[model samples]
Target: MDSQKRLARTAGMYYLIVAVLGAFAHIVRAQVYVPGDAAASADNVVAKASLVNHSFVADLVQATFLVFVVMTLYRLLHHAGKNVARAMVIFVVIAVAIICLNMIHQLGALLVATDPAYAAAFGVQGSEALVLLLLDLQHFGYLVAQIFFGLWLFPLGLLAIRSGMFPRLLARLLMVASAGYLLDVLLQFLTPELADAVNPVLVTLFSVAEGSMLFYLLIRGVRTLRPAEQAVLAA
Candidate 1:
């Protein structure tokens, strides 16, 4: 297939995979965790998670999907007639780098758990004394990337909103998603734990935004980002 057709095929699926991952991570866990009197005990949480079968393949799939999704979004921006290729490229590069760093940090933390004796001999630990100190370079990278992503979404939302090319509903949704991300950033400083506890909600809002935008971009081919409007959204 030609590049355009290939791009068209991928445009919609990327956001859907994001939603699926969210459901698996949140909804599935919620089901397994139960609630109230019948809730799984703290001890049982690990056991129940274990029963679900920890598959490295799942992680690989998610990582691969995100990479492709980034690539697809780059192309989608091109299709939107916005001169955003360089910005999108930078976004993808940072995203991949941070995610890779996160995977490594997670692995390092795991090694400490599975081999405490060996880890101690090697001077490794599952967790450091301070949570802030414990945050690896990747965690910080992820946070910075999220801020960038939120910033990026504003231009995207404005493009959708002004162009009249997309459904106003989807455009509104994207704006809302952009707001949710900014909210996450603000909430992070005031209360990290609370922000994290409600992270799924924030992410869900973002997904609704991206999912709506991606769907319209695919089916309707909205080319709304006029030269002036692009700058406003880009801001």
Candidate 2:
């Protein structure tokens, strides 16, 4: 009904879209990627070329919508802390840039998997290896982008906590989620065996934290600022 509520809902809507599409793309990739078996992975990709294409499109769309999510949140939260809001936007921008560039690896994988010219030039075995390599690059590139993804949440949590318009508990959960993301990335890169053991818990934490924020923004919106709180923020 009011401008703040409208903006909150808009941000929630965009966030929801980005989440769904990103999940879809990830699911598709997981289905096709065979971990270490390049031939099997290539076969899977070739068999599901259409699905892979759709996933690529989903990833691009997700990246685009992610920008909207952060920008809308920035507009709504900027009054809480101008520098933190700007930092959130900057982090998202960097993440989005990495995501867009990362898509090239996905495209390369698809091309190497499906196009006859690649097979003819490189031989089937070689082409398949290239596909696997490209997909590997794409996966690691996403993790690199995720570093900023987690960093953005820290500033977002700070803004939410400072705003006096959202629950402090939820804001704190977001900060915890930020730490979870960073830790997940660290474990994934440094100690993958340990990461495999720990990642499920981290994923659950991230989901709970982000899911709570998404639902609150969509359903309850932000609470109205009290006159006293507004005066303090203005000062």
Candidate 3:
């Protein structure tokens, strides 16, 4: 295949990886976490240690692959606008760093759940609370990372619009989705009660915006590149 197609496929592969792993992580967490019940959450984790371990590993893998996804996107979109592309990469890098760091809390939760030392020190109930607290930190850390996630999208959407390689409407919707991301993050931090209220709508928009881009890359690749661009890819 040609450069654009190759890049598209590669990106799609990584995106799908990230999506699958991320979904699995959420699924495992959901299986164990009772939202507000620490004791129940701990019991679930202890009982399903394998699932919790899998979730942490999945998260780490997803975060690592996300960096490659950002790099490939930057390579594809930089020609459209160097500054915006650079900004996009920067935001994604920061977000990835935050996400990777957040995984430590997941590890901490696992340790608190499984380690005998923690059990001895805190006792069962206290250990469960600590695990829940660590997981909560991971959740909040993700919210903070979402700020950079949203920032990256603005430039990505802008580049998509300007590049002429993608549908204009898709690009426009991406910007709208970016707004949703920003709004969601703000609500999460500023008015957490309101965050849950708007989460479904925002998540829907995000899924549409991102899913469209992913499908486009996987199915259509990009519009045929100019000769010079094709030459660069060949090199």
RMSD (Å) of each candidate, 1 decimal: 7.2, 1.2, 3.4
User: What tens-digit string does per-residue lDDT give for candidate 3 at 51-154?
Assistant: 89989999889989989998998888898889999999999899999999998988888889889899899888899899899888888899899889888888
Candidate 1 regions exceeding 4 Å error are: 1-6, 22-60, 79-81, 119-141, 159-165, 193-204, 214-235
Error of 1 at 79 (Å): 5.4
TM-score for each predicted model, relative to the true structure: 0.61, 0.97, 0.92
Task: Note the Cα lDDT for every prediction shown.
Answer: 0.53, 0.93, 0.87
List model 2 lDDT by residue over 1-235, tens digit each. Answer: 3999999999999999998999999999999888789999999999999999999999999999999999999999998889999999999999999999999998889989999999999999999999999989998999999899999999999999898768999999999999999999999999999999999999999999999999989988897878898888778
**Candidate 1 per-residue lDDT over residues 111-191, each given as its tens digit:** 333444643664432123211122234345456656656655665555545444466777677667767877787777688
Arranged by lDDT, best first: 2, 3, 1
Stretches of candidate 2 above 4 Å error? 226-228
**Candidate achieving higher TM-score, 1 or 3:** 3
